[model samples]
Target: MTILAELPTPAPTRAAAPVARPSFAARIRRAAPPYLYLAPALVLLVVWTYRPLAQAVRLSFHTWNLLPTSPITEVGLANYERLLSTPDLGASVWRTVLMVLGILPFSLVIPVVVGLVAARVRGRIYQAMIFAPMLVAPVAAAAVWQWLLDPGAGAVNRVLGVRANWLHDTDLALLTIIVVTGWHIVGFAVLVVSAGLSGINPDYADAAAMDGASRGRITRWITLPLLSPTMAFLVLMTVLLSAQWTFPLIDTLTQGGPSDATTNIYYLLWDYGFHSYDAGLGAAAGVIFFVGFGLIAVGVVALSDRVSHHDD
Candidate 1:
């Protein structure tokens, strides 16, 4: 045993062989696939989104009529100054805020209630029915609503027994548009909320039930906390896109009037760009909206991160 220990311990064992470093080309070859996989998406994003955004920014500095023959002349901040001083700008922005507020109940609040109740439903037919409105094309839906809300010989007036011009009256037009837009898009919100509901683990609810918690308590506590992320997402989407969602309907039904009562920022931008042929004004408004919305998005995202609760 002494001799075995005294043999210099097998020359103190050679240090482990140093691992051969991969060559630079080998390292690059290993990294290439991920970037290669990402290239198509990156290229398309740059071409479609960023490129147009850059063009819009550049166009905002120049006056143009959107004609090829019309030379673009740089007017610096003239477009912005005109836009800020325009009374319509303030009115349009206020209408946009109203649209967002009106859309919130349909997109977030009611959808959450519907989603929670829908979990008890045992058939796909009811689910399909609930989601059917979202499948209808916006133009087609607008056409149907136009017929239904006609000032004369309309079903809505016939039922209510009043010749109220729902779409043409300045007092009722915006509210009517809001309701129609909500009906058109609420199904999509319900679908998203239902999906979020299905994703929640049942164990928490079951445990709560075993602890003598009522259905209302379970929903208010376990279910809603888990659904907060989806609710936040819906709120964010409604705030950002309510005006856009109403744009097509407004164009089809009201054309932003009975005195521009239904004209949100989106319709105003379209009117400036296409109807009035004021490309620089439209671009300036677009840039302002893009920056403003970008800031709002950042704030909403930060708030959502703080408030949203993940089950895991």
Candidate 2:
């Protein structure tokens, strides 16, 4: 008798189960994980930025020092009206405007040109040397200028063989302030413009060159247009933060002085807030300052977007 092996039977298969489809809300919830991760930052932004803005708006409407003992007077727009009529207020606003204009061209045009030219520089040495001034603190830069413009110990007068007082002269004081501020921020501007230039597709410039376009022609038609967004952002930032960026130098070096020639709205607010112990006045000034700059910045960026067309 021979032993025989039994053949195995095939297992029966079951019907395929339906694929589970996510509902609209469930999909949204799943997609929301990234935003949920951002919740801490969102909360911080609201706390630091919006909370003060909201409080400032309410405080601006009333004449309150925001001190414990001080009473809040409901003088709707009185503080604003008072801010408008103050004599030095006009000067502060005007000086701020002038600084914006002075800084805009210096920060926007000069650095961009320098950065472009530096891109073609032979070595890293030259590039670093040119960008060095921007690494210095604004206060330190101003102090250096103060020494240079000393009219006594400063080498500027000695080199030029002139005894003219730089700080004593009110007419020159504001201009000097601009120069000091510009030197401090020049490196940053150069860095931003250089990054923008580096990001530009060299292919466009190459194509333009192939078409017999001059260096200047390619720069004017191709390079500059693409750089508009970066320029626009810088302009907006300089406009919105004109005082904060430059005022510290003025505060530390000049104290807005010689005769208030360099005094900006920030200086005015600071004087009132700290020196005069009048937080109500300072708060009013702060509100006025914020609103004016905010409006101007909004207008500039809005206008820029209308005129600009960026390539992807």
Candidate 3:
């Protein structure tokens, strides 16, 4: 009887209450604040940047004169074909390469040297003097160079005692543009490299000095390696944006003249769309350039990643 009573007297179990899932409205309520915060930026990006990009892509497949009255006629790959067939396009790309190469010494090498020197020099005024060019407006700088580079009666030609048309001559036009662009952009590079130099620990240099390392050796081994990341950034920026940096100078000075000698891909695109009124061709070129540059940028980043040594 005791065993039967004990077996029968098991405590009654209560049924578990089911957990409630959040409703769609509750989920939306929880997410509302972040979305609200992001709304303005998202709207602006969609309206200004993404929308124009999408429109350009769409327009690339169609012929458009950019006139409101003109109907957009779908031409499939014709615009791309035309771009490929253009002789100037190929030449423009090569000139662009040369431009980047020409600018590299000024933008990367010279600035680095100047920055290193500036670091050793104990004056903020010296640093400011180096960076003054960057503060000037591009158009204003171009106008000033326009006067200085004049073939006849210009200061440069007068000083050199040569009546050389610096900007108008075919052989000299592109090179002249490169030099001007470099002058304009070098100051910015100096500022950037100087900032990088400032961040490097003096202890490294001190330690190397104590170890009997020469100043040159210290710079070569310690300073440069630590500054690799900054150098890489400058290199990448110079390569990718060289065309853009030269645009204002090209517009104001050359206008893509002297047999299109100074016309890089950037100018070519602008010439097609604005000057030639071939929006479709310009859009096609834009798409190709965008893709090509994007790939280049990715490759550069990868290479920089492998080469750059983070002090951290």
Which sections of candidate 2 miss by over 4 Å?
1-49, 64-70
lDDT of 1 by residue, 1-312 (tens): 111112454554755744998788987986798799999999999999999999999999999998999899999999999999999889999999999999898898888888877788775787688678888888999999989888687789899989998888999999999999999888889888988888899999999999999999999989999998888888888988898899999999999998999999999998898887889989999999999998988898789879989876
* Candidate 2 C-alpha error for residue 245, in Å: 1.6
Which residue pairs in model 3 clash with each other? none
Q: Residues 1-312, candidate 2, lDDT per residue (tens digit)?
A: 001113477975855634798788987986798799999999999999989877777777777654789788877877778778989899988999899898887789897888778777755676577679877877777788889999888998999999878766888888888877787777678778887778788999999999999999988898889888777777877777778888878887778888898898888888877786555567778777777777886698678777654757
Candidate 2 scores a C-alpha RMSD against the true structure in Å of: 14.0
> Estimated TM-score per prediction?
0.86, 0.81, 0.90
Q: What is the lDDT of residue 253 in candidate 3?
A: 94
In model 2, pairs of residues that clash are none
Question: Mind sharing the TM-score for model 3?
Answer: 0.90
lDDT values, one for every candidate: 0.88, 0.79, 0.89
lDDT of 3: 0.89
For model 3, residues 15-91, the per-residue Cα lDDT tens digits are: 56337867889868866987899999999999999898888899999998889998999999999999899887799
